[model samples]
Target: MGNALRFLYGGFFKPQSDEPDSLGPHGVTISTVGVSALAHDLSQFDITSQVPQGLSQHVVSSKKAQTKPPPKTPEDAAKLITQTLKNHEKADVEVHTGHLAFYGLPLPHTLVEVETSSTPAYQPQHWKFELHTLPVDAKAVADGDGITVYVDARHRTESANVPREVHESAIRRSKARAVKNYAEADALQKNIVDAGYRVINGPNNDDILVRKYRIRLRGIDAPESEMPFGKQAKEELVKLVQGKSLKVCIYDEDHYNRSVGDVYCNGTFVQEFMLKKGLAWHYVAHDQRPEFALWEKEARAARVGLWASSNPEKPWEWRKNRRNGV
Candidate 1:
């Protein structure tokens, strides 16, 4: 007959004190016992003789063993659980003691939740956008920030309309100095022009002054000094402003050192008038005046100054094309 020896890891296993002893059924007796082969309940918890480097095998297991989960160390796991709670819709899981579990075993390895309250942080940087109106150089310099943004152009602000006498006095004062050979008179005339006003000289120096308001001729793109319409443009401007009163609004100067403004005579904008006369074309590139396009249409229709040419290019386009050698 063949003999078999079996060891009983009991209900109370003294892992440390009770050294490995051969087993009998009663009172820790050493004997040969027949191996009872019923399917050894493989599902129930069992204590193994194996122990980790720092831990002891005296560790206990119970029916409640399945209830107490092993410790979790992954920081990501905790974060994910927090996020899950934040986004929890149905509230299927409950938090017990800081450990999160669905049912009993830890949730599927992939399940992650996000915190709704904490959003990603972001910082916007300084950037450039187009403006409807050219920016004032002084403000641009002071702001020290990037250029002012505009949809198409800068919004024009309303201005006060000075009386004809005020303009006349300015011009007469300048002329009197010019007649006296005092340089102040010449300087006065220059100031008036720079301020978008003009002084008209009379026959006997006791002349009527016609000041055109809001005329930024210094910045307008007229024909070059020697160009056919350059002199005409100046003459035309003098004629327009000399006898007429206009509603003028001033604006900032551009890189070309041109002061841009809106000049109106009898509520008719002088820019529109000039565009129709073909004496000037649109001077802007990125930020264009509102009337730029409309005046272009009018000029095209009337075959005004530049439109007389078969394919007269706009000044901005011409300059750009010249730069690109196209």
Candidate 2:
């Protein structure tokens, strides 16, 4: 009776399978169902206890998260964005606030040309897209801080028509500035546009003298009507000094028996004004007044009067060409 009770108990507890079971001394062969049964039976096992003994540290991500964008102009902001993106090549930095997108690179040099945004949002604003002019060196100089830009003597003296003395004066002033002589430099720079010398003509029949004097513009060759803008130039000179009494200081005389000197009106250089108006060009025959070149340059930039054309023939060249019929 005892033997029969043991046999019945073993049969009831044994796993049931069609194949006979084979067990190794150190391992157990488990069927898919048996493994599932074992796992279900071990639901209370501690999963944390199964990790390898030497590797259990928590991982911390190295990525930096961005929350706000620095304030800047759309152009500047784009620069910052480009730098920011390049810096985070291996990761992402999200800029969730005030991020504006714009097109074009607008720095490090002059933007000679540009086109405005055609997008519907910007159309109503009538934005100024064209930069037809800038504060050119011959006419204006921007300040260092750029807070208050000082206009150069461009209004009356274009680069192409600036006087030689004026350029020498500017060089002296620039030298002063180089040495940090701020006050002297400022004074010298201001004097560049001031009338350099005076002009005087032969005395009138009356001892009192017809006027202060008659003076000839020292360096430039005013255009004659035969040349481009020649008539306009003569007309311009007539308007500036014809009836007006001028302060003349004659330094020399030209081959034409005319006094060669700088003419001033109320202490303002009259030829300087003419050059600024592009009424004449820097003459190389009598004297190559490169200083006046800047005055001409400024006029060209402004495209005023004679400089309005892309290529206005110089008076000398025009005369030579006319003679040669080339």
Measured by lDDT, the strongest candidate is: 2
Alpha-carbon lDDT of model 2 = 0.40
Q: What would the TM-scores of all predictions be?
A: 0.32, 0.35
lDDT of 1 at 248: 37
Model 1 deviation from native, Cα RMSD in Å:
31.6
lDDT of each model, Cα atoms only? 0.38, 0.40
lDDT, candidate 2, 1-326, per-residue tens: 12221221122112345654422111223233433332332232223323222111211123243322242222333344333322333233233111211111122112111111111111113322211111122111111100111112332323445477766666676568668998986676556434532111223521110111113466676776666777677666555444343444445655654445554544456556777788777665665433355456557768988788888877667778888998
Off by more than 4 A, model 1: 1-220, 255-258, 313-326
Q: Model 1: per-residue lDDT, tens digit, 1-326?
A: 00000111121111223443332211222211111110021111123322112111212344343354432322332333333333443222322212332212123232332221121111113111111232122222111011111111112221234445456557567667657955666666676656544455444664333323212432235554344555566566555544443343444555644334455444454565566677776665433533354445557767877677867655545556768997
